[model samples]
Target: MMNCQFVFLLLVIYMLYLFVGAAIFSVLEQPYEEQLREKVLNMWDDFLEIHPCLSEEKLEDFLRTALLVKSFGVSVLRNISGFEVKWDFVSSLFFAGTTLTTIGYGHPFPISLSGKVFCVFYCLIGIPFTLSLLSIVAQKLTIFLRDRPLHYFHHRWNTSNNKLEWIHAIVVISILCLFSFFIPAIFFNFLEENWGYADALYFCFISLSTVGLGDYVPGERSGQRLPALYKLLVVGYLLLGLVCVFLMVEIFKNLLKHNQILSLFLLGYEAGRQDEEIDHVSTNDSEVPFAPRNDETTRRRVTHSASPNEKSYGSISPSRAPAIIT
Candidate 1:
């Protein structure tokens, strides 16, 4: 019952967060949306006046068709933006990547029946593959990046696990913010036309989070130089960025598992026990290539177990082993 309550509490918080986001976006964007609507209406009226032969209903139908094409990422405007092909090799690769990552940016979607059917099957297979890939990459990265290095320092410097965890959290957050967001945002701010630093930062955060709002996709403007290269780079960024996110999440989860008191408070007793069980499997999983317990760690544990401090400082309790969610 306590676990259920905790879960429900988390759900409520999540719903509240979503509602807050909806309210904020509505407040920010609705006025601009209304203004754009009125502007479009005025433009239509003026166009009808200038082109006296065109009927309002006919123009409306034409406008709808044009919008439909635009939604599929094809521009039909009168040579305002040059003909940018949506189905090129690079574009298809980017689309495929986004699909596998489950980003699902709203534009350039399939309108045809066959293409849509293919997309359904593609996602069915691809999303799992992408997830597995992310898991594998994260595991490999954590061994080199988090597990071994932290263990080495813990033994060599005689650092406590709690200190190491705090350091890991702060360092990882800073590094990810720098590489995954800040640096890329700087590049995007310069590269994207009419985009300010905030817009670029928003795009980076949204893309990395897999929100893919489609409000401000990079390299979508008119006559952009090296468009294919830019798109391919974006795909690469998504792949690496996702891996970084996965690694960061795994680290924080480990932090939580190691801090049993915090876990009990946050997850409740039943859920924390379940999490502990999962952590045992995670320890087993590490036996393959990048297990948290490297040979050095094992030797250190062996040496430390003979000491008087084994229970107090050397070995972590079975209940508090670092966990992965698999």
Candidate 2:
């Protein structure tokens, strides 16, 4: 129950963060969008005034086609006026977040040399920071789950630790899959004008895994209402999904730590056993065979025989001599 409450609190905090980001980006981008629209309209009016021979409808069609081309970062007719600003604050912020997370959704990118240089430095710092943060959070969340719910189940059922860990992992992973992937996919399906549930699910999976193929980015379609809000929510979903992925990884790590079946696949244990056997054989080979100690009579006979006053030691062996001290 405590764990459930903690989860709910985290959800609330995440929702609040999404809302705040949406509000800020909306405020920053809306004015720029409006200004750009006004500039385009003014250019069209000037064009119509200068080319009075052309009908307004034809002029509008030509300008619309030209604007479409401009959207793709190409300008076939350069003299025609259109607004082209890609690095507004909100887009830049979103790009930075995606880059740091390694999501790299290619909706927007740096085109200038200085901007590219800045991006290189930014990622060098950001990637490690993001990875460290993910690891720390993953560890804490795994410990919380293990100690609270997993412990409860283990003591109540008198189960083995390995079994309990597996049970805990399955339950937690199912919940994460439901919330982070399935539920968000449904939400994105509804919010994105062109995306179906399958596409949304694929996008969520790709973004969370940091594959970010860039084919199905959300909130960038034409005629999207409250696009900033949608983009912000997508960012929040990506972040939360990544956290759950990290949590799953940590849980699986704990499970593998005690899994006998998986341990059999490791060669380290075999290597250790071979080392022990080799040490045992080397120890046996190094041992010196014991010999019986010579008695005092044997020593005296050897010394007297070697003095040369008597027969040679070999010829006056103990077998040929009378029993002296004995």
Q: Which candidate is the best by lDDT?
A: 1
Among these predictions, the greatest TM-score belongs to: 1
Off by over 4 Å in 1: 78-83, 258-262, 269-326
- Give the Cα lDDT of each candidate: 0.82, 0.74
Per-residue lDDT of 257 in model 1:
76
lDDT of candidate 1 over 1-326, digit per residue (tens) = 55667778878989999999999999999999999999988998899999999998998999899988899888886775442788878888888998889887877888789999999998999999998999899989998889888888899999898888789778986897789998998999988979999999999889889899889887788888898999999999989989988988888777887777767666475676688789997687545432133455543434433444434343566776779789
Query: What is the C-alpha lDDT profile of model 2 across 34-152, one tens digit per residue?
Result: 99999989998898789899999887788788876555544455452322233555556677878899999766776679978998998999999997898788889887876688778
Local error of candidate 1 at residue 322 (angstroms): 51
The C-alpha RMSD of each candidate to the native structure, in angstroms, is: 12.8, 18.5
**Clash pairs for candidate 1:** none
